[model samples]
Target: MSTNKEMKTATASTLNQHVHPFDQLTGDEIIQTAAIVRQAKPEVDLVFNTITLKEPNKQVMLSYLGWDTSKPRITKVEREALVVILEKVTMKCYEAIVSLTHNTLKSWTYMPDVQPMLTMDDMFEVEELVLKDEKVIQECRELGITDMSCVFNDPWAIARHVSHPGREKRLMQALMYMRTCEEDNQYAHPLDFVPIIDLGLKKVIAIERIKPRDSKYSRPTIPLQQHNFLPEFVGEENYRKDVKPIIIQQPQGVSFTVKGNEIDWQKWNLRISMNYREGLVLHNISYQDGPEKRPLFYRISLSEMVVPYADTNTPHHRKHAFDVGEYGLGLCTNSLQLGCDCLGSIYYFDAVFNDHNGQPVEIPSAVCMHEEDYGILMKHTDYRNGRAHTIRSRRLVISQIVTVANYDYGLYYYFYQDGTFEYEVKATGELNTHVLAEDESAAGMGTIVAPQINAQYHQHFFTMRIDPMIDGQNNSVQQVDTYTLPYPTGHPKNPFGNGFTSDYTILKDTKEGQQNACYETQRFWKIVNTDRIHPYSKTPVGWKISSGHTAPFFAKDDSLVAERAGFAKKTLWVTPYDENQMFAGGFYCNQSGGDDTVEVWANREVQDIQQKDIVLWYTFGITHLPRVEDFPIMPVEYCGFTIKPCNFFIANPALDVPPTNKKINHSVLAHENSSKGEGPKSCCSTKL
Candidate 1:
C-alpha cells in the first residue's frame, strides 16, 4: 500500500509478463472470478489454463516509481487486472476471457499470444495415457518387461523437439523409463519412448521407440543388495540427532545491513526478489563511496536457458529444451532447509504460487540469503619488513533451488565486497537415463551411471539479460582487443611471441554491433558513461563484462535446437534496450516457430547504442559428459560469468575494506575471560 511496501513487493513491468512474480491468479481471485463466470453462463465448465495479473507498463513504472521509490511522497495507486483463460471442456473449444478490475470481474477482449502449453494435468496424462495403451502393454509383455515405470517429458522440452515449430498446435511430451527401486527409490532414467500428443487432435501424433543403451558398461548400477553402508553408531539412522551435538552460532555478528528485500554491505547495495520464471532478479545495484553513490552495474538477471542433448536418435533428436521459456525455473523451485542447504545466520524469503483451483500457496524457505567468508579475497606479505596485508573477502550469496523432473539446479547470484557481480548456476541431480540390454554400445552417447542405465551427454546454455545503467542512464559499449606489435618504437621488439598493444572499436549502430564477440585475444568490453569522462584518464568511467568457463554451441546449424534458439549461435549480442525485449530465447517459446527472439530483435536495424539505453545478451554453458560419480546425484558443477569495474573507479574500490583478523589465537577458552584474552582481531577504522 505504501512505497516502502512496494519496494518489498515482487513486481514487474508489462514488458515481459513472464518476469512478473506469481502472475498466476491468486486463490481468492480465482474463486471470485469463477463465480463471476458461472453466474453469467451456468453451463460453462471452465478448464482454467492461465490466470496472470497484468502488470503496469515499464515506462509508467520508471516515471512514477523509479529512484528509491520508497519515499512516502510517492502515491500508492493500485491499477492491476487479472488475465484469465477459461477453456470449455465439454465442447472442446477454448475462447472465453475475463478480467478482474477494481469494480468487479468483467468480460475481457485481450487474448494470449498463443494457446498455453500442457499444464500439470497434461504432464500427468502423458505417463497415464502411455500406461493405458494396450499396444504398449502387449509389446512390453511380449518383451518380458513388467516391473517398469514411466516418467513424463518436460512439456517445454517437447515443444522444442517437435519438427514443426509453428504448426499452431498444442502438444505434450514424455520419456518411458525402466523404473528401479533405489536404496532410496527414485524414478531417474528416460526410456526410448518419445510420445507427442496433439491436444486439439485429442490423440498422440506419434510414438517413436529407439534402441536402448547399456548403463552397466560405465555406470554400474548399485542395487540395494550391493549398496555399501557404513557401520552405524546407532541402528536407527533417522534418530541421528544425538550423533553429535552441534549448532551454528555467531559469537560476534553479521556485517550485512538487511531491510525487507534490500541488502547493504560494505560498499555494495542491491535489492533481490523471487519470480516464477527467473528465480531471482536484482535491482538498484550500486556501489557506495563516502557521500557519493557510484554506479557499478544495474539490473543483472538470468534471461533464459537452453539445454540441448547430443543424441540424434529418433526421439532423442528432439530432446532440447528452452528451460526458462518452456519450463519456468520459478515454478519448479524446491523448499530448502536452513541447516541442510546452507549453514550460517540464515535468512529466507517465501515464494507465492497458485493451485489449480486458484488458491494462493506460500512455499516457505524457497529462497535463501547469507554471508560466507571465501577464505581470503586477497592477501600479500613482505618477508623483508615482516609487514603484511590481507583482505579476507566476504560475499553475499543469494540463491534459489529448482528441480526440473530428474535434475536439480541451483541459480546463485553473488555480490562481493569490491563491486563484483557474479552469476553462477549449479547442476547436481539424477541424470536422465535409459535401460540397456546386454548387447549395446555406450559409445558417443553417454557414460553408464548405473547397471543397464546410460546417461547421455547434453549442453546447458544460458543467457544473461543485462540492463546496464552504468553511471546514471545513458551509456555506451566498446570492444577492446590486444594485437601483437610488429615493431617496438622504444626498443628492439622481441622477435619471439613478443609485445602487444591494445585496440578498441565502438559499437555505434547495428552494423558495428555485429563486431562484438568473445575471443581469447580480446580483453573484456566496457559499459561506460561517455558524457561523463573521468578527470584523470580522460576516459569514460565503465565496468567490464567478463565471461567464465563457457563452451560454444555444439548443435549443428540445421539442428532444431539451433533453428529455434539462434541466440546460442553467438557468444554475445548487443541491442537497444526495449522493455519488451526481456527474453533471449523469445517470448512464448513453448511452441515458438522461431518467429520473434533476441536475435530477431538484434537483426532489426540497430539504433544509436552509445550514450543510449542498451540491453546485452551474453551466452555461457558447459558440456556435460557423464561419469560414474554422477550416479544417484552429481556434485554441483558451477558455471557462470562475472562483471568487474574497469575505469569506473579511480583506484582499488576495496582498498578500504577491513581485514578479517590480524592473527589467530592459540589460547584456550578460559584465557578468553582475562585481560590478556581479548583475542586477536583486525583494528581497521569502522567508519560509516
Candidate 2:
C-alpha cells in the first residue's frame, strides 16, 4: 500500500508512460487535472467533488482492440478527466473536462439546480457542525445528553418531496443517537429529534422532532440502554467453544497471474479498475478456449442502488437513500483485512480518489481477489461396475465491501471454469434504527429490535450495468419462458398432458424491452448474436441470465422514491449503448427531483435495440423486515443473478475437467473404519 505522498512521488516519474485506456488515473493525473481547472478559474476557490477518468468512446476502443496482434498495435489514445467542481463563494456546481494528455482544460459547463455527489469530507463536517450548534446543544441537554462527545449523528441525503425552497437547496438530515461511552454502540439509543443542515450556510436550519401520537405530547427522553455486539462488551465468555478453525493452504501459491490491472485465471481473462462512484468495475472479459479468445462482456459494474424505507410517517418518509448517486460507494469502501474480509492467497487492489482539497487519497485494499472452493462441478457413477467419478469446482472471486453509514454491502463477481459468471450483493450491517413512538405498535410498519429502537421495513434495490459482447458487439435479447402446449390432451402436439416447451421472444425496441420476472413461466433472458449459430443446436450463440431471489418495487407510482429511482420498477431493461448513460439514476442525484433515470431515458425516445450495440440494466433487491435477531448488527443477506452459456458452446464446457484424486486432495476420514480403503478404488479419469 502506497501513502498519498509516496504515490505522488511515484506517479510523477511514471506519468509519461502509455497506459491502457481502461486503467485508472494515477495520482499525478488527478493533481494535474485539478491544477488545470484552478489555473483557468483563478478568481474563486474551488471545492473538488470528483475527478475521474472520462472513459474513451466504445467505438474507438472496439476498433483499436480489434487490430491484429501480428501487426504493430495502435498505441495512441486520448486521456481525459471528468471533474465536478463546486465554487466556494458562489455555491454553484460546474462540470469540466480536462485533456490529461495535452495538459489543458477542454470544456467547462455550469450545472444548474443540481447537487453533486456528497463527499466524505462533507459528511465529517456535518457532524462537527451539528455538535457545535447552540440549538442542537440545547436540545441535547433537554434529552439528558450533556456531553457533546457522546452524541453521534449519521448524515443522510434528503430526497425531494415537493417544489419548496427548502427542498431545492443542498441539504442533509442528521439522525441523532446517544452513546454511553466511547466504544458503545449508539444505535440502541436513537434520539427523537433530527437536525437538518444546509450545506451552503453550514448550519442547522431546523430541528424536526418526531410527531406525538396524542394531543398531550411531550419531548421523549433518549433511551439509556446498551445493545452491544462487540465481544468484550457482550461477555466474551458466552461465546461458543466448539467452533474449530479450518485452514486453507495453497502450497504452490495461486493459480492466477496478474499483469498490471489484468488477471488471467483458469481460462478467464479480464481487467479490473475502481471508480470514484462505482467501486469495482470489470472490463474486457473473455474466456480462452484452445487457441481462441472469445469475448464475453465489454464492461460490468454496479451502476446504481437505492434503499427506500416503508414508513409513511413524517421524517421517516424522507429516508430513501441513493447510496451510489448521492454518496460514492468507492469513497465508503473499507480497507479490507486478511482473514477477516477474504481468505487464502488474496490479492488486494488499492483505489484512489480526490479529497476536498483536490489531493489524491488512497483507500488501501479496496478490492480483494482470490479463489474459493465451490464444492463439486460434476459427478457420475456406473452402478453395475461400482465406478464413480467426481470433479471438484473452483471459482475466482473479485470483490469489494463498502460501508454507507450504518449498512455494509459486499459486492462480488464470481467467474467459473464453465464460462459462467455471477454478481452478488451481500447486505449486512447495522439497521437504520429510530425511536419507537409510545402510542404506535411495532407491527404497523416497523419492528422493535431493541426495547425502544424501531427498525423500519426497507427495500434495497440494485442495478447492474452489463455491456455484453457475447459473440460480438451487435447482439439481441431473447426472453425465454417455458409453457405448456395449448392443445387438447388428445391432440398430436400434446399427446401427454405434461408436455411443455420454451417460448422465445426477441425484444426488438426499447418500448417493449422493459420486462418483469414471471415465476409461473420460469422466465430467463438470453443475450444472443444472430450472426453466428451453433452447428448442432441451430440457435444463436448466446448467454442466458437467470435472476435469483428478487422483489417488486413497493412504493407508489407517484411517490418520491419511484420518481427518483425508476430503474427498480422492472427486473430487466434494454437500451442502445451510450457512453454518457452510465448511471441508471442519472448523473447527479444528491437532490434530484426525478427527471433523469433509466425509466425516463427508455420512455423519452424509443430506439431499436435488436442486433445493435446495446446495454442491459438488471434490477434486483430484497425487502428487509427486521427480526429480533438483527438488532445490534445484521447477518449477511444475499441476492444476485447468474449468467451462463446457453448455446454458445458446442456441448458441456466442463466435460474435460479431470476427476478428483486422493493424492491431490489429501482427504482424511473422521472415523477409522476398516472398510474405507476397500470400499471403492476410484481411478481419476480425463475425457479425451
Best by TM-score: 2
For model 2, what is the C-alpha lDDT against the true structure?
0.85
- Cα RMSDs, all models: 6.5, 3.6
Q: Best lDDT goes to which candidate?
A: 2
Q: Residues 1-688, candidate 1: write the lDDT tens digits.
A: 1111111222222122323222333445556655665566565555555444444454444444344344443334333444334444321324334555543555544344454433455566565676666655654554455643522344434645446555356666666554334333233444444566665555566766665445344322222212212234224654556456344444455567765566787778877665556667776677786687765455677888888888766677677777677766766788878677766776777666444454555566777777776667776777896556667777888898888777788888888877787888898877776655545656677776666566889988888888877766678888888877867555566555467888766788755664434565665677778888888888888878777666778888877778778788776778887766878877567766566787777787656777877877888888899888877667888888888887767787788776655342122355264456554455332335
Q: Work out the TM-score per prediction.
A: 0.82, 0.95
Q: Which parts of model 1 are misplaced by more than 4 Å?
A: 1-55, 65-74, 81-121, 147-156, 160-167, 182-190, 199-205, 212-248, 295-298, 488-497, 514-519, 662-688
Against the correct fold, how does model 1 do in TM-score?
Answer: 0.82
User: CA lDDT of each candidate?
Assistant: 0.64, 0.85
The per-residue C-alpha lDDT of model 2 at residue 295 equals: 90
lDDT of 1 at 89: 35
